[model samples]
Target: MYIGIPKEIKNHEYRVGLTPASAHELVAHGHKVFVETHAGEGIGFSDDDYRAAGVEVLATADEVFEKAEMIVKVKEPQAIERARLKPHHTLFTYLHLAPDAEQTHDLIKSGATCIAYETVTDTKGGLPLLAPMSAVAGRMSIQAGAHSLEKAKGGRAVLMGGVPGVEPAKVVVIGGGVVGENAAEMAVGMGAEVVILDRNLDVLRRLAKRFDNRLKTVYSTSKALADHVASADLVVGAVLLPGAAAPKLITRELISTMKKGAVIVDVAIDQGGCAETSKATTHAEPTYIVDGIVHYCVANMPGAVARTSTMALNNATLPYALALADKGTKKALEEDKHLLNGLNVCKGRITCEDVSVALDLPYVPAEDMIKEL
Candidate 1:
């Protein structure tokens, strides 16, 4: 199998799909690996680094896309990248297609086998490939929210951990999942008063035990969301519905009621967003004022720390990648039910039910579509 790693082209997305070490493992497995020149340069891995790891360095993305059988990328394919995709290509990356109709249609029209990392499942029914990046985004949400609360950033000018004589700023996390938990962890460590809300009792209990009562874990309700958000200095929208668009829990009316200059970091922006005003922003201009509130909704938060993110993501993706490479996409997916769950599109058909429903497209079961592959 020949695998290609193209430099990520998303705005401020510096993380590469596979690291030098990860590519080396593929080479050791007798698979040929090709990467676009400077793909890993953002993470301080030079072309020589990839060469040292036995990877062929292509001078252009066109050549890499032309030669590779499987395209391993960090972010979704841009318009040009998507145009370059051929029917023979297998794209393995994070494709948040639920919200992007253009991407979904382009993928279908390209007639390639698309496997989304975020939808891939583990034996325990958890999103393994998405977890590492989610953890990174989760932790970063607090850091971003804290910074957004400064006066220069048009925040309320309150410190996260206020002086002993002053009361600490309040932080409200909208979900108690990985993102919410990590955000709460960081906020609590910074000595801010934190409240985490979720609809799941078991998740709340787990978080309660993990935090040891340092942060308040509350049952999430419409009243709770409204009351807590209105009073919070920093609100982290960490809700997720898994392969579906995030529910708009924070309404425009709700934002207008919040304290002036309060900050909101919508971690669920990748899946559209949990807030009505949350639009995808880039690190170049990461925040905007919406109804006098600050919104930090950078779609790729982990990209800020490319080196750490690349390594962490590779650790989680390498195994499944090897499986697909070793057994071939159809065979590998057929063998592993969890991996099969990752197949979003194959042979010009939508294989993921969530995406089919989200995009209102015709559904073809993965099993049926892979047969012709």
Candidate 2:
């Protein structure tokens, strides 16, 4: 099997799909790895490093895409990259297709087998591949929100961890999953008044125990959410619905009534955001004001910390990548039920039920598609 790694071309996105160590592991297993020139340069992995790991360095993304059987990437393929995809190619990456109709249509037209990292599952029903980046984005939410809360950034001149003479800012995290937990952890560590809201009682209970009363855990209700948002200095939108679009929990009307200079860090922006006013921003210009509320909705939050994000992502995705390379895509996915869940599109068919429903496309079960092969 020939595997390809392409340099990410998203705005300010520098995370590479495969680290040198990861490529070395695949090389050791007798798989040929091809990487675009300087793919890992942003993360301190030089071409020499890849060569030392026995990877072939291609000068252009076109060559890598042309020669490799499986294409590994950190982010979704941009328009040009998607155009390079062939029917024989297997794209293994974070394809957030539920929200982006253009990308979805392109992937379908490409007729390539697309496996989304965000949709992969574990035995315990957690998104193993998505968890690493989610944790990174969750922790960074507080850091970004804190910066956005500065007076110069159109936020209330409030410090997250207030001085002895001042009260700390109130932080409301609207979810109790990986993102919300990490966001609340950071906010509490910074001495902010942290509160987490979730509709799941089990999740809320677990979070309550995890935080040990350091933060408040409230059952998510219309009234409760409204009350929390009304007083929150910073709100972290961390909700998710797997491969579906994130629910708009914060409406425009509610946002209009929030504090004049409040900040909203929408970690769920990759899945179309949990706020009505949220739009994907880039690191170059990360915040914008709507109704006098500052919004930090960078779709690729983890890309800002590319080195750490690449290594952490490799830790989770390498095993699966090996499975696909060693056994072939159809055989590998047929063998592992969890990995099969990652199949979003295969052979021009939408294989993820949630994604199909979200996009109003025809649903084709991964098993059904694989069996036909």
Top candidate when judged by lDDT against the true structure? 2
What C-alpha lDDT do the candidate models reach, one value each?
A: 0.94, 0.95
lDDT of 1 by residue, 8-100 (tens): 999988899999999999999999999999999988999999999999999999999999999999899999999999999999999998999
List the candidates' TM-scores in order: 0.99, 0.99
For residues 176-248, could you state the per-residue lDDT of candidate 2 as single tens digits?
9999999999999999999999999999989989889999999999999999998999999999999999999
Estimate candidate 1's alpha-carbon lDDT, on a 0 to 1 scale.
0.94
Give candidate 2's error at residue 172 in angstroms.
Answer: 0.3
Q: List, in order, the clash count of every candidate structure.
A: 0, 0
Residue 347, candidate 2: Cα error in Å is 0.7
- Flag clash pairs in model 1: none
